[model samples]
Target: MNTRALSSIFTAELRLLVRNTAVAVSALLMPLVIGGMFVVSGLQQAPAAGWGFYVALMLLTVFGMSGCIAAAGTLTYRRDELYLKRLRCSEASDATILAGVLAPVVVVTVVQCLLMVVVTAVAAESLPANPVLLVAVIVFGTVCSVGLGMATTGFASSGEQAQTVATPVFFVLIGTAIWAATDLAEGLSTVQMLSPGGAVVQLTQLAYTGAPLSETASGALPALGGLVAWAVLGAGAAKRYFRWEPRH
Candidate 1:
């Protein structure tokens, strides 16, 4: 990878992302709104799980879903405009180009996650039981989301249709997260544990409870495995189907 080329591309993408009003609102402001609502609903009075769960959910929702959609939107938009095609003709390698495009979303997600942590800590005195494990979860979630976003772009022929294709995916993830939070049938709960979004929520809930990795390894291991499987699957799909030029 050409470091200089990657840096330049990353800078440009970051600037464009920040300037887009819709992305700015969703990526930066939406989490704050949701967190505030949680606090107002008396989450602050509960134990670590209260604030911790809310914070983790917000991070995954904003950083994972919103960030993923933004990346997918940008990819499809660029393809429609032929920008991706033009970029491919440059000196940058394919991997470098992809890295550059993905960096901005990753950076945004990290910043938002940190901000949410600080807010949660100040409001509810909630902190991660295992900070290292939490970090790993965040990294895994981000990678899974980004790869899925890229793969989703393969189905979109234009920017408008990109929204159509991504919406169902967005809702399915949200639905799974909701189902994971509730008490459900034994069979359904097992299914949720096996899904990427559900696995992240389970791991986040575990982390929030301040349980040590050794103690929760039985649960945490499967969640981690699920995320890893999704990451691999999403990456493979993107590699096989992601398009640079617009489809005719």
Candidate 2:
């Protein structure tokens, strides 16, 4: 990793993010607005499961919008403007360049999640059963979201097109998370556990429900595996299709 180059690129990206109204709204404002609604809607009186759903929903919203769609749009814009091509010609390696480009998105997403957790805890008047597990799952989810964002850039010809191409994926993940939150038949439950969104919901509920790691290992392990698989698939797709220059 070219530390100096990475720092330079990361700083520039942050400045650009602030100037970009669309990306800034998606990354910062939308999640806050949604979360505020949740709190105002009596989140304090809800049960543990309700809190779990809230956490899951927030995660989906932030990751899907900021981590996935925003990342893709930002990448697409950079490529379209020839920024990525110029970076490619620099001394930085491909990995470093990509990392620098995406670092701001990742950082903002993490901060959002942390803030959500704090707000949720304060509103609900309770702490998660397993803070460690919650942190781990959040980190894993961020990775999956960012990787998927990278893959989404493969299908985007421009910044606006990135949002269009990412919509289906974003919806699928949100749908799966909602599905996993509901009661399901055994076979369907298994399928949900294997899906990226469903896995996130499952792990999040478990973390809030105080399920012991030893006792919940059977279910948690599979969900964790599913997240890992999705992350890998996204990375693979990005590696195969990500472009440094915009398509004509």
Candidate 3:
């Protein structure tokens, strides 16, 4: 990969993201709204379990809406506009192009997570017990979300329809997050823990409560495995089905 070329593409992608108000609102503003609600409702000051759940919910909000839906829309729009095809004809390799497009969202999501942590710490006096796990989960969650977005883009015929194509996926991810955050029967909780979103939730819980490594690992293994599976599945589907040209 050409460092200069990648940087240039990332800058252009960032500019494009900034120009699209809908993208900005979906990717950033909406999550902040939800986070604000948690603050306003004083959930941040709740018991350890409740605080953990709030963080998990916020993570899902930002990751699903931005990394998945917003990213799908941007990529589909670029495809419809022949931007992706044009990039292919340039010196940028496929990897560079994809990375460039993904960089901004990943950066934004990370920043959002950090800011959320800070807010919780200051306002609610809640801080993650395992900061490293929290960071790891955020990074992996972003990767999976972006991969899922690209995969979802394969179903969109145009930018206008991208969100529609993404709706089911959005719901599943968000729904799973909600389920994971709620108390459930033991069997059901185990199933939820193995879901893509559940994996992220588990990590968030560990970070929030500072569970011992043995317990955290026992739970995290399944969640991490699920996350890896989703990443592979999404990336493979995108590579196989992503449209490089507008459909007739």
Candidate 4:
């Protein structure tokens, strides 16, 4: 509701985000690096979902990781610099301040996804078959990533240590999501549906295939539940555990 405060905060966040080359590139660079590795190993040319799907999905995966890292790292950095604690003294409310910090990161996340779509279509000569699903996956994944980032800063001692602390969770969740996507493709086993990555992929595929939601309940429900659970838990954990000052 504080439009002026929000705008001011958003601008500041944008400036800071772009000023750090490492953070700025986190969203785009991480995925491109992973994709190049695939290309180098010749796995990109393999038969699994074709190079296009792999490229597109790989891009999505990277964005998810980048968003998480940025969210966690930025907050941790600000806390280290005492920005978060100082903002508590401003006219802006806590919610307003939080929104401002996250807004630009969210915008960058969307742009990265849009860029991924453009690049995949052009370079891979591929089509998204279900453009809506692509949008949904990216949007949902962003929410999940950003929320997770907020949660991460809750425990971070310093900006420098954030990468080390946050990496395991990022890799575990994403790794789980990836496994489900690959393992469940052949059939819908109960265990497979429980995987977050699998669930996201199934939802994505259903969107692509134009299949009805009814057929995807196996993976969809649990996956949606998992995502929802994480979102709720992360936000709650953030609220309950987040510190406005440097732990030191």
Q: Return the top candidate by lDDT.
A: 2
Each candidate structure's TM-score, on Cα atoms with residue i matched to residue i, is 0.88, 0.93, 0.90, 0.83
Candidate 4 lDDT over residue span 1-248, tens digit each: 68999999899989998786666666557766765564444344644454433543554465455767777778888888888778879999999988998888888777766665566556655556556556666766777677777777767787656655666655765576567656544754555544445545555555445445566455456655555555566567667766777775
C-alpha lDDT of residue 238 in model 1: 76
Off by over 4 Å in 4: 35-56, 210-222
Q: Which stretches of candidate 1 lie over 4 Å from their true place?
A: 42-49, 184-188
Instruction: Give candidate 2's whole-model lDDT.
Output: 0.80
Tens digit of per-residue lDDT, candidate 2, span 55-91: 7777777888778887888899999999889888889
Candidate No. with top TM-score = 2
Report the error of model 4 at residue 86, Å: 2.1
- Name the TM-score of candidate 3: 0.90
> Number of clashes in model 3?
0
User: Candidate 1, overall lDDT?
Assistant: 0.71
Which segments of model 3 are wrong by more than 4 Å?
42-45, 48-50, 184-188
TM-score for predicted model 2 compared with the true structure: 0.93
Q: CA shift at 10, candidate 3, in angstroms? A: 0.8
Residues 1-248, candidate 1: write the lDDT tens digits: 99999999999988877786655555567656875776555463574334545655676666444566766777787788887788899999989988997788888877767776777778777777767667766787777777777877888887656655655655666567767767422322657877765776777777777778789778777777887787788688778878887876
Tell me how far the alpha carbon of residue 219 in candidate 4 is from the true structure, in angstroms, after superposition.
Answer: 5.6
lDDT of each: 0.71, 0.80, 0.76, 0.65
